[model samples]
Target: MKNDSYPTSTIANNTKRILVLFAHPVPQQSEVNIFLFEDAQLLPNVTAVDVYAEYPDFNINVIKEQERLVNHDVIIFQYPLYWYSTPSILKEYQDLVLEYGFAYGKGGTALKDKLFFCAISAGGKEEAYQTDGFNHFTIRQLLQPLEQMASITNMTYLAPFALFGSRSASREDRISTHREKWTTLLNALATEHIDLDRAKNIENLADLTINGANE
Candidate 1:
């Protein structure tokens, strides 16, 4: 059953609509993203779509999904990082919904002028994502493919909103931090306060923490 609480036309009015495509295999087992999504859902002009729950059979409604994309000004992909990438369903959704003639290639102007961002939860510590760290690569490098995808689709790619140390973060801390960040991101998007130029220059959302503080 699709959640139509926030219709597409309603999204085009008053505020810039932010469609959050949330993908998690087991939401009950999630600690960070769940709270973040819950908090984000409460904000006006923000709509949360549980991809896994909505399309468990992988039978995605491409037209409907594309319609949702065209109606919103910003698209936020929310998920738990799996092996340094997004969950399986998200990839599937991208492949199916963001088709060649629709999101890219000739006549693919549906997503043009739109914005794309990510909100992800990682199981590793921040240090581990560094060049000399265990993971041996920055999160920015790991997420380059999505940036390229956004570029190909003519969408403005913004810095992601990431929560590291998910595996070790205390339940209380996880909830608190994710909620705060979710609220902050929503407010920035709602009020057009985000620094798009800075967001495009940075590799990862974490990098924005250092840059945003200076601004």
Candidate 2:
């Protein structure tokens, strides 16, 4: 695969750890997300978890989840955009794991200063999520609640990395390229090569121009 314009390994380190909370109810049927998760899992300092598979009963293990969060510097909530929000289990994970005096409230310093972001796959085209489009709002506008969640927890919120039109027919090369970029970003993130502020301000981390955002 071509490296394209971005330097996949321009920098390197495993100091910052990453946790990918992949919440797909029917992961077996996934075409893109599953591949991204598996590739990310093979990288150094990255942990990918299938949330549904781990807690099928919706009975979350709060302590264990919290422990997982504590070990990672970056926490990624990866899921397909369902009704402009996350899957039900992610909400459940938050409700159960982010307890008082832990994720938010007095002494809620566990996730403070950590990095938090989302990776979403949308069935609609990118233009459909704009002011004049059928959806009538940008992706960022729809993610305000998540941004607030990061604010409350004192975590840095980076704009999401999204793949739109997932339900549409796709060319093999295009899919291959997007898959490569997924691993590239994961590698950059593990090495602390991304400019946090740049990532936060960018409209779309998946934009091809994101090469400029990497440090």
Stretches of candidate 1 exceeding 4 Å from the true structure: 1-14, 171-174, 203-215
Q: Candidate 2: minimum summed lDDT over ten consecutive residues — where?
A: 1-10
User: Model 1, 1-215: lDDT tens per residue?
Assistant: 13222233335455678899999999998877887778878887788899999998999998789888878888988999998999999999998888776777766667887899888888898899999999998887888899899999999988777778887676545557556656766777766766778877776554454223112
Model 2: per-residue lDDT, tens digit, 1-215? 11122112211445678899999999888887888888878886788999999999999998788878878888999998999999999999999989877777866777878889999889888899999998999999999999999999999999998888887625534566777777778767777677777888987777634353134
Quality of model 2 by C-alpha lDDT = 0.82
Q: What is the lDDT of candidate 1?
A: 0.79
lDDT of each: 0.79, 0.82
Q: Which ranges in model 2 have alpha carbons more than 4 Å from their true place?
A: 1-14, 169-173, 208-215
